[model samples]
Target: MADTQTYKFNVGMTCGGCSNAVNRALTKLDGVSKVDISLETQIVEVQATIPQADVLEAIKKTGKPVTPL
Candidate 1:
């Protein structure tokens, strides 16, 4: 099995809807195993076997600016 990696991202989420959208987009990815989002902090943490680029792209699809941390 592929090693799981933890990726943190700075997502510009102003509301619950924004965070939820990011969460849904990330969770739908095949290699993503878990997702944790904090709207207050505007951060999203993802546990996945996929590449970090893939995770970043997933979050981007939500139409929010994402900065990988």
Candidate 2:
């Protein structure tokens, strides 16, 4: 089973389209099972077994700020 991890991103994503941009970028990474992003709080909730380090890197690849919660 994959573990669910919640993260907060500091990127300035102001719309649903921006959310989709980040989602598309992160979802392509290996071990990422799911992603739920909130533009209001700039948070991303992910379900995956990948290491937090890899996750962070993947999020950065999307040009977003990601912090563990």
Candidate 3:
């Protein structure tokens, strides 16, 4: 499998807590390497070896709307 893959998300995280929430959720997934959240941009950039579907599920589990970036 690839070492790193980028997955962009349209996460509506309004505060630092929201960002952290999304970050932690993504970090807990199977093959995530790192997560970069931009509150200003409303985007959660992810680096992972896991599938996008899994990542999406994790994001959805946060109880916030997310879309591929």
Candidate 4:
């Protein structure tokens, strides 16, 4: 089995819907094992076997700006 990685990002999320969208987007991606999002801080932490770039791409699909942390 592949080792899981944790990727953290600062996303431009202003509300619950935005956070939910990001959560859904990441959760749908293969290899993604977990997703934790904070709307107030606009922080997202994803645990997966995928690369950080792939995680970034998934979050970007939500149309939200993302900065790696």
Candidate 5:
């Protein structure tokens, strides 16, 4: 089995809608086991076995700027 990894991203999320958008986008990607977003902190946490680049691209598709932290 692939190792599970946790990735933290700083995303510009304004509300629940923004966080939900990010969550939806990320959940569509293969190997993404879970997603956790904190609107208050504007942070997105992902648990997955996928590559970081792939995850970044998925988040970008949500139309939000994301930075690795």
Candidate 6:
């Protein structure tokens, strides 16, 4: 089995809908196992086996700017 990895991103999530958007986008990717977003902190924590670039692209699809942290 592939080792799961966690990545953190500073995103612009202001509410539950924004968080849910991020979750939905990332969860659709094949290797993504989990997605956690904190609207208060504007942080997105993703646990997956996919490449970081792929994850970043998924987040960008939400129309939110994301910075790796």
In candidate 4, position 2 carries an lDDT of 95
Clashing pairs in 3: 8-69
* Candidate 2 global TM-score: 0.72
Candidate 5 lDDT (Cα, 0 to 1): 0.93
**Candidate number with greatest TM-score:** 1
TM-score winner, 1 or 6: 1
Per model, state how many residue pairs clash.
0, 0, 1, 0, 0, 0
Instruction: Tell me each candidate's TM-score.
Output: 0.97, 0.72, 0.90, 0.97, 0.95, 0.93
lDDT of 6 by residue, 1-69 (tens): 788999999999888898999999998999999888888999999999988899999999999989999
- Candidate 3 lDDT by residue in tens digits, 1-69: 676889999997888898889988988888898888889999888999988999999999999888887
User: RMSD in angstroms, all models?
Assistant: 0.5, 2.4, 1.2, 0.5, 0.7, 0.8
After the best TM-score superposition of candidate 1, give how far the Cα of residue 63 lies from its true spot, in angstroms.
Answer: 0.6
lDDT of 1 by residue, 1-69 (tens): 999999999999998889989988988899999999988898899999999999998888889999999
Which residue pairs clash in candidate 4? none
Q: Tell me, by lDDT, which candidate is best.
A: 4
Each model's lDDT: 0.93, 0.74, 0.89, 0.93, 0.93, 0.92
Better-scoring candidate (TM-score), 1 or 4: 1
- Residue by residue across 1-69, what tens digits does model 4's lDDT show? 999999999999988899999999998999999899988888999999989999999899999999999
Can you tell me which runs of candidate 6 are displaced by over 4 Å?
Answer: none
Task: Give per-residue CA lDDT, model 5, range 15-53, as digits (tens).
Answer: 889999999999989999999999999989999998888
User: What lDDT does candidate 1 reach at residue 65?
Assistant: 95
Candidate 4 global CA lDDT score: 0.93
